[model samples]
Target: MNNRYSSNSAGVFTWFRDAAEQGNAYAQFNLALLYKRGKGVQRDDKVAFVWMREAAKQGIAFAQNHLGAMYYNGTGTPPDDSEAVYWFRKSAKQGDASAQQNLGLMYRKGRGVPQSDEMALTWFCRAAEQGVASAQSLLGEAYAQGLGTKRNFPLALAWFRKAALQGDATAQLNLGLMYRRGHGVLQSDTQAVAWYRQAAAQGLAAAQRHLGVAYAEGRGVQVDLERACSWLRRAADQGDVDAQFNMGVMLSNGYGTRKDEAQAFAWYHRAAAAGHMLAQYNLGGMYAHGRGVQRDPAQALVWYRKAADQGAPNAQFNVGVIYANGHGVPKDEARAVAWYRHAAEQGDASAQNNLGVMYANGQGVPQDDAEAVRWYRRAAEQGHPLAQYNLGGMYASGRGVERDPVLSYMWISLAAEAGDETACNNRKLIERKLTREEIGSAQALTRRWRDAHRA
Candidate 1:
């Protein structure tokens, strides 16, 4: 008996035939691999499974692992998580590191059994201690988040460093982030740059993006917009949405090359299609303002809706405006206010000021000067000049609170200092009317309040 597929001189068919008959485990596994991948043979899952089963029954750990993977990924047989788990357990019991890692993944992701972080940790710990870089990285993540152990930043850093040193690109990038953001180690931009450079050389998209940022900002590296654009373009070419968006902006503004609206639009469209919220917002603006495409309010609203669904504040506000003005749909005051409120909650200054106006004019809600004043104050505290001006008017006219010209001038002057042209003119008009001593006293109180607020 012989393996027809294992023939050195004889034809492959004769080799596989002899190998199949002779019960050669390696030959059987190799034949299965060929059949599974349709290499030197027609793809036959049933035949592949049959051959692999024979090898696995022979206690060949490699065959056992491949057979388990086939079951796990549904490549040869109906996907059977339980069967995959069973064979993986057998291989793991035999001390197969790959099987150990696979078993750990199944437990961690709850693929075959009830999820058990502790069990996952146990397997990952075993593999990691055996010098498995992936397991080390996973263990680092678990330690960082305290998945099955007490949160230990020092342990996480050690494990991440170990895995990073092993040339695991993911570990390298993640360790770089830890150093860059001071997550589990002292913030060391130099170390961050080193790790990032290693991972970037391996073409890891995330590491490339971070490296691009490092280069652009002169953190640990001299500022080089050209280098930043190069790395960003590489990641963007790989369909990294964040990288695509950043590269698109650079292209749109001619950061390192002549402005190319067409190319910028294409990149933005790709990122937006990938569910990048910010890209969707930018594309929406392009449609609305005719920057790269013909002005199409309907398309603008469509893109805006996509971003708004992902909780983008600016997109939500823009969509609301379109609805309010009947640009894309029939005028809907209620919907407009809804979007305005969403943007305001996200700390959008313009949206906050708009919300105050909405409350004041009762466009979509009942007129309530108190609500208006509340919103205006919120925006004013954030240095919204218009909000400060509105607050001053409220104080001067007693629209929301008791009338007080001194308090009004205080807000007006604050707005003026913040470069509100209208506030400056109004202050001048009020200055000509107020008595000199009264103006001096008002100015004194303003100074004290400003000093207290550090404004």
Candidate 2:
């Protein structure tokens, strides 16, 4: 049948060429399609463009639409958005559905036209009403995102269903997300999985990634790490950054696969290069700890800085540690303080405690006992054991706040409960200095504080 079809097309090619040369618009359009697709004629985009332009000039709506696409895509000519919009508008005004959708895209993206969500919506609605699956999906997205109108989840779901049923992969993926998120319908992981499966089967990388996550988390299915790894690997192979990062996590943790630090590092490097924040942080850890690679503190700092610049508090804290210890660089206490402050301001307990030590020791900024106590208290309130011990020492020595033996005993007791050996020994020493009544008061305060702060 394929051979017969090709033969039949070849038989008609001469007739189409003759009629097109005679200025017949319909014949020119047919000949253009043949040249464009290499069906019954040698493929030549330049020849196709010539014939398509002639037909379009003759007011053939579909030919005008095709010519607009060629111009937009730079097929056989330099790309020209303005000219593409001109032809698209001409065909769209003539009720060509494809042209209407193309015009909507131009307005939506501000390509060869002023960006106008309302105009894009109007045109998308026109094409979608004609049952164009891509246009329907775009309309769904517009409604879902409140691009032109107020968010209408129900309308978005309706359009997504219409397009998905027509086998549009993007619509299938979006419909799966809608089901998963319960946007306009009851949340149903089973339904989401079904839609995701369809889209994934179509080779959609994002759908594969979503399905991989679903399998890993046991949403709508039994937990199957192997299946999750398979799907994630598929997406990662297709250059999906999230999937690459997930692959690093799974490989590093030996989830459904043999633990392979080198592979994990490779995957993390790929994702980090693409600007995945978590991947960058993990890559830093790998470099710092010599996991799957030679220890390289300089490289660790580079990756940590990348994540820190993106506002990762843990990375900021790590950057401060590196600078403070002079790991792969000159020890710069002031720079350490700057980095520590970045993380501490975001309520990182470890950073708060470290900042307190810097203040108390005059290593970075001036030695200020009050500031040290302030930072230490913040971390202590968060149940940081080291901060509790440090704060207790400050109270005992009268370096910060008023001298209060009972308060010092209470803080030391909390740290001792956390298994700090130094706190336990210091607590025993403090106990000897207090009278029986003061000791009883400190014990009661410790009990009350523990009860109030229990997690």
Candidate 3:
């Protein structure tokens, strides 16, 4: 219920005071509203509470609802959940839709009553049936998630449509998602875009970000990088981390805008501060390569470690490189080995190759040709040119298994095709040791391997 009151007529305050003195409930409620808003009266929560209490005691449903809100929020009196619940229950039983919705929220959150999805659903149904838009939205969500009811996509769609038609931003967003995912509706990018536009116009940040991505990817609309940037900026201004990251990428790559590395760095830093893993990794790159800031190995390591701690394989590999190369820290081959192992276990080919080199040289691990061959094979299967060359050398020298010239030739030839200069030179030397028929067999094996592993 709106509590705004105007003292436009002359002597209105005096008239209200006289009526309230004579026990007029409307006059008391109106006077309380005026006092609460400081309209032609001194703002005094205590006075407002006293007058509101008098009106509520006289069975004024609106006043009782307001009293409950005031108690719940500690606006006029100390917060008392029980008292708020009592007033809300009284007003709700009298068909006050707002009170009923509020009571439902309280039950859903267990604020003043035991948490009961059934009670929440019952109250929400009552308010929704009375055409309360927010209650309709909540009821739709409950149906969609099967909270206190069977999951019913059709009912959810119906309730969401009702609330969306009433201009509820959240309902519009949810409706857009349903259309996009084909939940209880035919998948239609056009329909999703329409609903997203409604919520985006209402200043919903998530809707703005989703619309930006749709425009960028040409999913629900024609590709429009300028429009995508505009929408992304709007969401980024509202502190949306994904939007901030996207903005950084667009600015850095000069996508539909002039390249602004400094601005991109700022956006990336903002997202990184919010704990975005990719943002942290990119921030480390910027520091390491001096992309938009001065090169600082120490800062690079700091950001890389942050991303690494979050299980970023690339960051872990970079961390290993940094320690192995002694960039802004003491060189520690053992620490490098540990970091490389972490990334290699996650299937990072570069880390696998590096681990193979470490094992072969016995820098941070026991000198074991078998362990080196194991790591090299893992990386080679993933098409790592360096690991293929290393594995070929191991086979030629019989360092791990018995020397096999045909296998060595095939592996080195594969590495040479990948533009490894060392492998190309090594392949020419190994060719002199093989017969013509052996070379033909190795060439055929290479073709079969390439076809089988094509990705």
Candidate 4:
């Protein structure tokens, strides 16, 4: 389209310049647009500003609006918010929808005048009424968020629908969100997907990502891994961070495509570089395991620490393990305990179990049998088998709580049933110390507990 305009620019410029020199406001505005776009001459904002100012002085509303934009952006002159507002107000008062929308934005952001939602809404309403799709979308946002008036879901829905029908991608995306959340319309995954598809068809990256997730999760559509991967790939190519990370996961797991660890690593690296915590954690694992890249404990530690700093419990646990084992750094029991505690406090069962062992052995903190029992119990109740067996041992030895042969038998029996060989051996030893009746009672207790925790 630009090429078409440039091709005939010389003839068009001569015609417009002749009329503009004869004081034709329309010709002046046309010439200004041509100069601004470099249609016939080298792009010159100064010349564009001169012609636009002349046309605006002759009361051409569009020229007035253009002049305001030039002032607001410092395109041809020093940026002056006050001057921009002056021209916008002049054109807006003359019933120019674009000018009204621009004025509303200036007021909304406190760019040229005092921030005033009420005034912004007033101008937005004017432009929206005049069928300006951008203004309609902004009006919908105002109503939805209670920016200038009471929150009105119905009004917001109505305005969003108006703009969306005019092919406004943002409005379509917002409308989909409203349906998905049941804000102004009935909650309908199908309707949400329909609106999302509309926006996605227009190349909206966010909409594409949402649509891909919906397909992957079988929300509003049949589960279609291939379709999900296709959509996600599109959004990832556009640099959508979430899509990039998800694409990495899909590639790594062979979902909808052949497993390609190298490609997965590339995708993860891209997202991790963009500060995605999960990507950083996953990249750390890949590096540590030598999957798709050479094993590099230093690189693994770098990524793990990055994610751990963002409060990722799994990353914290990995960092603790690394510090404790001297992987890529000197062994530091104190640092290991600190990282373990950070994750354990966040309800990570594995971290709780590890912290229990650390306490029991006096690795970093002084040995405290009772503290070990407490952490072991926390992880055991969450179905950590190792913690359950450790708790059983604690009970059998009376290390933390009162020694109870039956309780030890029951817990050890449960852990043994979960395929822990050590627990099985311990259970046999505990059984030998119990009376027949006590052994039967322990068996019944294990049954009751398992039934209660059945998935």
Candidate 5:
């Protein structure tokens, strides 16, 4: 049987070579494929390129498409986006679906051509009409996101279904997302999980991550921590940063397994290395507290600074605390104030209260009672207990604005209600200095404030 197979292959090679030499485009293309795949000849990309070019020159669309792919992938020659685009355009103009898809991708990514969502969508539609699954998926995304056309949920869902039924993993994932978000179909976690399972089984990392989250949160499946951990580990092993971070959370909390602080730290470190902001912050906390590792304030500061630079308010506040206390560095009140300001600007009530204190005490800036009152009021309005108490004091002392026993009583009452023992005492003291009518007004103001800020 082997001898017969070898003989037939040799005969086929001979026949193709002779016809190719006689300028038969199909024969030249077939001979190139044989050389490229080493079916009947040794795989020789350079030699394959020669015959592919010959057939392509004869205006064979398939040959041109194959040659473009070779150029794009640098199979036989140096990778040349421009050359790939040229050949892909030629074949695509001849109604070649694969070439059309390739050209669309090239335009979509701005490789060898200006990025044009419209042009990409145009070619994707053409190839999709020819039943190209990948092109159909791209068309779905374009319609879903209004990339090159108006957002059309129904069209997106239709295209996604077409491609997904053809076994396109990306299409399956998108369809799952559409179902999850109720884009065109009714929101159904069960349907989302079903599609996610299909794509995850196909080794799609994103699908695996989504499936893991679904299982963890009991979105469609029961809350099965073990299953969630298993799926998340798969996605994490594939270097999905979000999955890595979630694994850290699971391990640290003993959700699916024993509380292994070391494993949590390791996972957090991995995601932090990939620039995950929360992971960096968690890593900093681990280092600072000696959780699953030796205490290293310097390392903590390093990770905290990374997360802070990424605009994490908590990390910024931690960085401010580190600078204020001289943890692994010299205490610098100015730097602390600056970091506090960063977090404060992002609506972090704690940071805003701390910044108010800094202004009040003149720790890093010139003492300005009016400025302190301004900062205190900002934080106090956000339901910050300390800021409310401080603002109340400023009113009692008549330092920032005209003294109003009513406002002072109101602010102090708010802080006291939030369980501040000192504010409780202070509220009583301030009440003694006010008339019954003034206290009544203050109480009414507090009620209005509470009603306005409920939630």
Candidate 6:
């Protein structure tokens, strides 16, 4: 068939129908786009695919990429991850940045292909180096989390900066966290606010929440509770749980706005219902304390259980306390210890200390001095004051550790100055026995440990 001139799109199709039938690749691709998008024709994905297949076979990169996107997104095609991957690979091999990024996403999520972080990284790096903004942001996250490469904060920051400079909202938010936390750059709250604002203006809910916190805390900007609440409400409207939870906290605490327990309760309930674990814990506290509503211990227990089941540290600790004290449920020391142990393994200092006491007293598990010291020491290293005090006493009495009077005096002296009366008393007793050289060595150890953790 010979190519024919046409005046309008419909007229072009009449001419193109013949050309497409005769396998003119350009005509086939044009007709396919029309069919695929339902422009000037009844929508027919099957027919569109047929024409696209013909055009793609003729080395049409755009057609191949479009077809791949369709398959990847399950638009006008049966959902087939493997088929999507095959099409994406075909287009990506032709240096299509979008295809490369999409292929990386597929590999990263294990969608329609075996999970391969390295493969994902390869594709993402290729597209990012090609200046694809989304790919740059995705690679930044992968690097930050050490998903496919060695943890390299500087490299992550570099990728985030590239994407953020290109106006990528997610990258802007990520850069904000990196800068604010001093992850790969100097801590700069001012810089964090700048990035957060850029993303927030783009209606990114996560950024809105972060911006609200900055305003509330007066970190990089003036503290304006009203502005913080406004931003938080905007994010909450978008169903961001962190925003919702923080907003409730502000309301309850009377920060920026008049205190309103009822309104706080409502926001906490909504966020808790949305499966926000922290909100669940907060909601439980409100219910248990009868702050916003009528006292309902059962309701409190329900919310606490929700958070506790998800392994929230504070929630687990609180739930254990509630059980032990018979606040909402029957006094069950056994249940309390179980909850404490769960949180303790996750390195919750309070839980570790409490569990140690439970073991030392034979409250839930069998009493074992060794277990008590083990749990207490774990908490003490993290600076849980009570655990530090308890550990020092155990050392002095040789209850859990080897009875080395010098070491005992050394630990007691450290805890005593940190305000543990038991340790202070023990230190006084040891002072009578230790020589000046041993005392000097213990003081030096404390100085070194303190210096190492100063900031």
For model 4, residues 79-141, the per-residue Cα lDDT tens digits are 999999999999999999999999999999999899999999999999999999989999999
Candidate 6 or 1, higher TM-score: 1
Better of 3 and 5 by lDDT: 5
Q: State candidate 5's TM-score.
A: 0.91
Q: What is the Cα-based TM-score of model 3?
A: 0.84
Per-prediction TM-score to the true structure, in the order listed: 0.92, 0.92, 0.84, 0.87, 0.91, 0.73
Per candidate, the number of residue pairs that clash is: 12, 0, 0, 0, 0, 0
What does each candidate score in C-alpha RMSD? 2.9, 2.4, 3.6, 3.3, 2.9, 6.7
- Residues 177-283 of candidate 2: C-alpha lDDT, one tens digit per residue: 99999999899999999999999999999999999999999998889999999999999999999999999999999997899999999999999999999999999
Indicate the worst ten consecutive residues by lDDT in candidate 4: 1-10
lDDT score for candidate 1 against the true structure: 0.86
Least well predicted 10-residue stretch by lDDT in candidate 3: 1-10
Q: How accurate locally, in lDDT, is each candidate? A: 0.86, 0.96, 0.92, 0.93, 0.94, 0.87
Q: What's the best-to-worst order under lDDT? A: 2, 5, 4, 3, 6, 1
lDDT (Cα, tens digit) per residue for candidate 5, span 1-455: 23555658877888889999999999999899888988778899999999999999999999999999999999989999999999999999999999999999999999999999999999999999999999999999999999878999999999999999999999999999999999999999999999999999999889999999999999988999999999999999999999999999999999988899999999999999999999999999999999988999999999999999999999999999999889999999999999999999999888888888888889888887888898889999999998999999999999888888899999999999999999999998888988999999999999999999998
lDDT tens per residue, model 1, 393-422: 898889988887887887888899889999
| Model with the higher lDDT, candidate 3 or 4 | 4
lDDT, candidate 1, at 194: 94
The prediction achieving the highest lDDT against the true structure is: 2
Query: Candidate 4 regions off by >4 Å?
Result: 1-8, 18-26, 53-60, 71-95, 99-124, 142-152, 444-448
What global local distance difference test value does model 5 have?
A: 0.94
Query: Residue 434 of model 2: what lDDT?
Result: 99
